[model samples]
Target chain A: MEFLNQNSLYIVLIITVICWFGIFGYLLSLDKKIKKLEEKINKE
Target chain B: MVFKIILGIGLTLVIIAGIALPMVSNPSSFFELPVVPGLEDKARIIFFHVPTAWVCVIAFITSLIYGIQYLRTKEILYDIKSVTAAGLGFLFCILATVTGAIWSKFTWGAFWNWDPRQTSIFVLLLIYGAYFALRSSIEVEEKRASLSAVYSIIAGLTVPFFIFIIPRIVSSLHPDPIINPQGKIHMNPTMLVIFLSSLTGFTAVYYWMFNLRVRFSKLLYQQQMKEQE
Candidate 1:
């Protein structure tokens, strides 16, 4: 487990965090944009 | 629904096994390493890197199919589908690049070596980036769809060459020269089960994403049309 604590572990954690948030953020933004469009359509 | 549930279970099991593989002792360990203890044994990256590339392959295949459909039927839905798939494909490409970069940093001393495989992926990114730029530049919907579809078909052909062919020809610092020239495998039965499980799980996730993106694009397109009317 000691080897896991080296600099690479930090690097991997950073990569994983970036991957997690980046993907979810895009998905959420796309959903939000679609919802706004739908709301506008309903108003019209 | 059952299939999705099964895939979820499979992904869970695979992830557990992947996490356990390095920790397991004796014959359970796939191959012993001389490196420092518990070096994060790279098999975990299979959960990430391979899955991203698989999703990208799936996305481009989808783009090409819809590209042809748009050309044949001239249906706006198909055009929307093609562009949406390409857009998602580009995102997957970026994901794959980042994952690969991180993996390289650990295995290789540096992250961005100008190796043949790396160079080709960079080129692939350029090709897809240009595709989106081409779409955004054109104001006319039909014209944008037609040009982007054609470009997508041409660009889709580059994927196999970059992902498969170039990697084979070049001497990589990667792994498994004798067994895995065709994208390293040869995991023991236990590891193989875990790897396959992850692949199935990711395929489900990919479809889920594709469905959502295509639906969003269709909705947006319809809304735009209504506004015009």
Candidate 2:
């Protein structure tokens, strides 16, 4: 807690990075799902 | 495959360098960022915030290009591309707005100051919001495509005016843009490199998302056609 109080910018950086990872993970999953759907449609 | 790997690594590096780098009054080395007088630590927001706005503009311009193609070709695929691009633009625009608003609360003492830049982006959100509303209202395929294409072209034309022109013509509390009236970037070379890298990385991510969206839309269109048969 004392360390974070002294280095608040790192907190912001950590939050920003977590948000970016969340968005990136969502995109990757969406990409995988789309690929699966494309395969299913092609096989139909 | 190689492109995605490089992009992932490059973007990760950009985020780390943009945020974690030390800011100093005098940057004697490559690793340190020169602190802007009015914005010290907060200046770091530029690497993240500006890229969202930049991606919004790129997505809007892409939407405009696809809109023109749809009008010229009268193709449903082009229409799909245009709308997907516009949707992505809207998403990025909202991201920019939210990020800017958060930064504003800390810097400007208020969340909503109605500054020229803020006002202009607000108006832009409305304009693009109406585009989606117009799209949803029309059920007919051909008519919807033609009308929305024309609307997107007009909306895109206004983007530069709102984002670039209006913010410059009027004085506001906003900091000088990277490309200011003096036409000089007053940034440390290290900071400039990181900024540009962030812009390139975000634009690449936008391209990836746009491809995924367009492909999904195309697949949905095909499924609908099959159902209609």
Best by lDDT: 2
Instruction: Give the residue spans of candidate 1 off by over 4 A.
Output: A1-44, B1-9, B23-40, B176-185
- B11-120 in candidate 1: lDDT tens per residue? 55555555443433344345432222233476467656777787887888889889888888889899888887887888888988887888788777678997676787
Show what share of the native A-B interface contacts model 2 retains: 0.43
Count of clashing residue pairs in every prediction: 0, 0
**Deviation in Å, model 1, residue A40 alpha carbon:** 11
**Candidate 2 segments exceeding 4 Å error:** B181-185
Alpha-carbon deviation at B161 in model 2, angstroms: 0.2
Residue A41 of model 1: what lDDT? Answer: 69
Candidate 2 reaches a DockQ of: 0.70
Give a tens-digit lDDT track for model 2, residues B1-229: 6777787778888888999999989999999998877778778888988999999999999889999999999999999999999999999999999989988998999999999999999999999999999999999999999999999999999999998899989987777646664532268799989999999999999999999999999999999999999
Question: How well does each candidate superpose onto the true structure, as a TM-score?
Answer: 0.78, 0.96
